[model samples]
Target: MRLYIDPGTGSMLFTILIGLVGAGIYSARMLIVKLRFILSGGKKVDMNANRIPFVVFADHKRYWNIFEPVLREFDKRGVDVVYMTASPDDPGLQNPYPHIRGEFIGEGNRAFAKLNFLKAGIVLSTTPGLDVYQWKRSKEVQCYVHILHAASEATLYRMFGIDYYDSILLSGEYQATDVRNLEKLRNLPAKDLVEVGIPYMDEMKVRFEKAGPAPKHETTVLLAPSWGPEAIFSKYGDQILKVLLETGYHIIVRPHPQSYTAEKDMIETIMKKYPESDRIEWNRDNDNFEVLRRSDILISDFSGVIFEFAMVYDKPVIYTAANIDTSVYDAWWLDTPLWTTGILPRIGHELNGLNLPMLHSIIDECLNDTRYAKGRDEARSEAWEHMGEGAVRTVDYLMKKYRELNPAERPDKEA
Candidate 1:
């Protein structure tokens, strides 16, 4: 008899094996720290004697837009901050701010190792899964603040992603309610949930205002989907493109950046199958404002870009009907339905096998429909409040928290 294992089980086993290896590495590192302390006759290691007062960590360069405004606020107020990133080519490294110092700290496990031993008064990050994966909380760090990069629900993160964080800066009050629900469900201590609005969207609004309107062109459809099994491209691939091309409308496909790396083979196959032409163009621009401006209607799955389009662009969206598996996410713990899914029907139309054949009609409806306008206004109010004041409010919260953690080193005035 031959032994057999399914792909799902095999993947799960591999993940467990990797996790065990990581645990061993972490144990060894801690043992070394302990041994050093014992050898020094009960004295602390003091790896970072000159502790940094404020620190910001970016796991990828893509999030620079989200942090740039806050860093600028810090600079304008004459406050010092350390910007650490895993990507060597991060734009934050090139920032001319006198008060902000940026440094590249390698990537993956190496970056996590450096962060696990950091010493800071308050460490702010957009990345989640602290103390759940490779990134462990450092004892020397007084506070860990996690800020949302999207206007979506905070429960959408992977299991226990933000559970260990000291505080979470939310974009809306609904998110705070969900966070509190999770805390009560898990018997966890409630952390600070501040509704500071969406900083990147505010920045995008400024850029859009300066760039003016997009040049007039043919009716355009932007297909921007999240990168995962539940995403549109991952499920239907070029089939969706074939359907859109039949409508004789210009189509733009801007895949999630992660698709280029995580699903490289899938993207390559799709691109090879349907090469770019005058009618069909593939977009991979770091900044999506140009493409977004030229688009009439958006076709997406569960990507946060939907909120950006509906809120910032003030346009309508056609979301694909894909069943998102929530078992691996914090959302599984909640009994209520996801807020994103609940609001989709109001703000846009749905695309699935039943309505896929009539995608052209749906696109036409979304483009010409005036009813969704109200939903867009309601969504904007719920997901993003105090639209243009995000950066200022974010800085205010950080400065106040820092002072609370270090009273002796408090500044004379707030930023």
Candidate 2:
């Protein structure tokens, strides 16, 4: 019996078959992964014999800015790396890095894209967007390193899917120890997390020192507000404006790229309200480190920026979590206060009812304390202990591990 069908129907059937085949392949991969665990329960892959093509995902522009060096290192190691960026923020992309650039896929198609990278080698992500972060963390990868942006321990442990990670390179020993504790927190055996310190900071610090002393800007205040599902304007937007105008410090309110893109009108409204608030510098492009380098004092809550200000630049950060609900937030954010890493004052939890006067007074205290200069150096020591210094140590260790497992040029693993 000859089966007859319209051309469209045939095309649809073929598409369906392709989809089914992909699902089957993914399923088989899952089965093989389980079998491998059964085969080698507690053993690292033989990196010496294996060579992984690295695929690093950079979701936001700023993240890409920070991750460029690690990608270059991967290239230097002869890692066939795929460095991707979704946002057009990276001007350097005009003269793109020598390694492969994988954009357009975004996070929705991560599984398909991941498989592509997996077949080639290991896929690594230094800064993960929500969707990409989820796909990578949901399952075990042969070699995917999550070099989280922050040097905080609590942030990594409380972060979802730590169990599935192969190696979490620590920015410092403090963060590394915190990651190791995930064993008890999640009731799994103690696993090792690498302490590399912050590659990003090392890059920044070198650049700053070479650039020479930062031009003394007036009492500079950096105001970066969070955006999306947890956008900033909703909580303490207006209130921050009131205080910033009154205090007279140089203010730069850079919205999270997510928030700026998602809520254009809201961003405009907020900008309109505070036209002269400290010479607003909205970073709708790349080069955030420039803004940070210029600013003296920093203010924010929950965002990774606090770590940047306190650790990398040796600046004191005032966390105005005026919009957060502490009891709910502490658990949800999971990561403990940054104070554990550096001096961090508690946030207001609620936006409007915040004691703005008290907040200013605290700011005054920090400003008056000439000892803060010394304290910043202390924070750097703490960061070094937590994240590390050389910046290359952690990556070197992982590459060393990778070489041990797979000596071949193509070990069938990706970063």
Best by TM-score: 1
lDDT of 1 by residue, 231-315 (tens): 9987787899999999999999999988999999999999898889988999999888899999999999988889889989889
- Which digits, one per residue and each the tens of the lDDT, describe model 2 over residues 96-170? 555545453444344344443244344556543322233423222356667766645435333454555456666
Q: In model 1, which range of ten residues has the least summed lDDT?
A: 406-415
The best candidate by lDDT is 1
- Consecutive 10-residue window with the lowest summed lDDT within model 2: 344-353
> Residue 379's C-alpha lDDT in candidate 1?
89
TM-score of each: 0.86, 0.70
* TM-score of decoy 1: 0.86
